[model samples]
Target: MAATITNTVIDLSHHNTKPDFAKAAADGLQGVIHKATQGQSGVDPTYAPRRPKAEAAGLLWGAYHFGTGSDGVKQAEHFLKTVGPDHASMLLVLDLEGNPTGPSMTLEEARAFVTHVRAVTGRWPGLYSGHYVKELLHAQKDPVLGQCWFWLAQYGPTPVVPPAWAKWTFWQYTDGAIGPGPHEVPGIGACDRDKFNGDAAKLTTFWKAGGV
Candidate 1:
């Protein structure tokens, strides 16, 4: 049941430092998703600075907000304000993992956040999580959350797709040391890597469509 990686995309934040987008492009990296904001107050300082650089390298750009225990609508507003207009080319995501910094976001809050995001952006943001999501959502079906594309975060051999989603759109198979190899990218030595469910052209279309 282990997933095979196509190595077309990657996701990063300030934690991985600045990457060499030129090298990454040469390495066949098609897109890059980075952390834009975390909670209401937290923002990734590197978000705006590296965007054009990544685009210059011909990599599709994306931003994700790490959900926190706050007013979901306000969080969505803050996330959109930070990310700017969608323009139909940039991917937007909701990171639904446990919040180590504070209280984790409840399913209710996440529902509100994603719904508000869809209401404002005219599209549903992708949802990124792993075991936490599986545990919470395994037995339940969420028509609202299910509308968003599922980005599976699994470091193990095989990933679990929650009952709400039929399958995963993107799989985060590694976080540097875990999951499958070749974990090293051209610019980044060891960082987060993901695989799309299709070929290069499909991946491009997916990115261009903002994971629609």
Candidate 2:
């Protein structure tokens, strides 16, 4: 069955402030996935501190790596080393949007990267990308790539499930500021907002399933 989409979450990076995770949690966020590393070299300085703080505040913690079309093995190594095996209790995502200014990842590169990360971590990292990129990659039929849980990014009133996906595990519904409304969260100002496919109890069960 398709998991029902509900619950609010947020993602952060160096671009945002050192978040007041307590404030975020009090504001009712279920989780936070932060940028851990990018390409083969860049690491988010805040990730080290923010991770523990987010956990302390009772938010499920996740980490993501931005693909730069670099050596897949090296990039995966950097990501794993930075986020560390202990900290990723919720999910590890492969930010597969590719470089905005440069070329996006080819299907082969995406597969290689995800494959290497899964080999090392023993868990398949969730695949994150926009709808267009999902279509470009032909994700539904690619044997190696299709195994990942999809985190679809589409800005709209409602999220559209990507091709071949029964449902998306995570949906990045907006990059705008979350706010004055009842659903507007504090601490995370003008950042990307996401939705889990299920409610809190279901999310916990899904997390415990270890990205299966």
Candidate 3:
């Protein structure tokens, strides 16, 4: 299946079984955003180990934290510590989706998390969410969160972008099971795929700028 966007990105976690970053790059995959931590306790375990391999394969690397009901400040601390420093071009993200097993993070908590991230990193992390944020921030703009780049997660024909931002910085079109075609990637089958709202050069700049 072919996508309208030229720059493609794939997000992964412990749930993803195998990840051949070299093959994924050969298949036109430009980047990988893997889960880093959850709440203040849970760590992805695979995040650190996979970082070098993904980068060595010539794929842009990224790390994201799954927000929980725990203290956002604490979660941010744990997340950054787990992911280490960005070094230069590594992308950092905050997954703000509604959690099933644990309590979902409130909008206030979400704000705090991003704020702390910026405080530590000197750059706001990309925010990843779907209907959870869509409904939560319907027609309203959060001053703090708005500073962070939006990573819309909508498995549909068109993304129902939140009103806070005019458009999405990165749109998660599929999660392997839903959204558009080619839900599976070359190395990692049946995973989340994202479309950057820019060309290859712009995507590289976005990564280097952290969230431009």
Best by TM-score: 1
TM-score per model over all chains: 0.95, 0.88, 0.95
Candidate 2, residues 9-32, lDDT tens digits: the string is 788899887578898888778888
Which 10-residue window in model 1 sums to the lowest lDDT?
1-10
Judged by lDDT against the true structure, how good is candidate 1? 0.88
Model 1 lDDT per residue over 1-212, tens place: 75444668899999987699999899888999999998987899999999999999888999999999888888898999999875478889999989887999988899999999999878999999988887777778898999999999998877678899988989999998988876889887798989888778888888898778
lDDT of each: 0.88, 0.77, 0.86
True-vs-predicted CA distance for residue 209, candidate 3, Å:
2.1
TM-score of 1: 0.95
Please give the distance, in angstroms, between residue 131's alpha carbon in candidate 3 and its true position after superposition: 0.5
| Ranking according to lDDT, highest score first | 1, 3, 2
Could you tally the backbone clashes for each prediction?
0, 0, 0
For every candidate in turn, the CA RMSD to the true structure comes to 1.9, 2.8, 2.4
Tens-digit per-residue lDDT, 1-212, candidate 3? 54335547989999998799999989888889999899998998898899899989988888999999989999999988888775447788989988999799999899999999888878888899888887788879889888888899888888777888777889889889988876888888889889888788788788877665
Instruction: Identify the leading candidate in terms of lDDT.
Output: 1
lDDT measured at residue 195 in model 1 versus the true structure, 0 to 100: 85
